[model samples]
Target: MSYADFARSIGLGGIAVDDPDKLGDAWGVALAADVPTVLDVRGDPEVPPIPPHATFDQIKSMTQAVLKGDPNAWHLLTEGIKTKARDILPSRR
Candidate 1:
């Protein structure tokens, strides 16, 4: 199950937010909430972790993974883009 689903199953209020604005909203809700809560910001696992000394080949493989999403892979390029956008932009009111 998804992380958010797992959290909810344990009686914690949770949200899997895909939008920047919704993320802020979820945070607010969690803050006001008396019980445990979770706000899952989806990330692309297919994108290789970028270290300071990453090689060109490593970067290329990471790019390929993003472009060709495998079901076995944990993330998608589109999700990565959306997540990055969310992080960059201010949440909606």
Candidate 2:
């Protein structure tokens, strides 16, 4: 059984999967609940780790899409890279 179901089975309060904003609200609800509570959040399960030579735009896009708007992920992805793909990669056109 899921965390929510498990919590409810034992007479505790819980929150189940929902949209991003709803998931945040669920955390608030879980915190405020008097009894023990569970906040079961669901999200993208296959976010890849940042690459060794990832670029600014590459890291930015990946952070926005896969990391769910995490700014720190972008910073980490681009930390030591001095140049972007546009600076080093040859244009196909």
Question: Which of the numbered candidates is closest to the native, going by highest TM-score?
Answer: 1
lDDT of 2 by residue, 1-93 (tens): 588888898899978875644655688888888998988765444334446677678866765674575656555445423224434667544
Mark the regions of model 1 whose C-alpha exceeds 4 Å error after superposition.
44-93
In the predicted model 2, the residue pairs found to clash are: none
The residue-level lDDT of candidate 1 at 52 comes to 52
TM-scores for candidates 1 onward, in order: 0.47, 0.47
CA lDDT, candidate 1, residue 37: 85
Q: What digit string (tens of lDDT, one per residue) describes model 1 on residues 1-93?
A: 477888999999878886645666788888998888888876444543355566668756876765575764445555544555555587664
| C-alpha RMSD (angstroms) for model 1 | 5.9
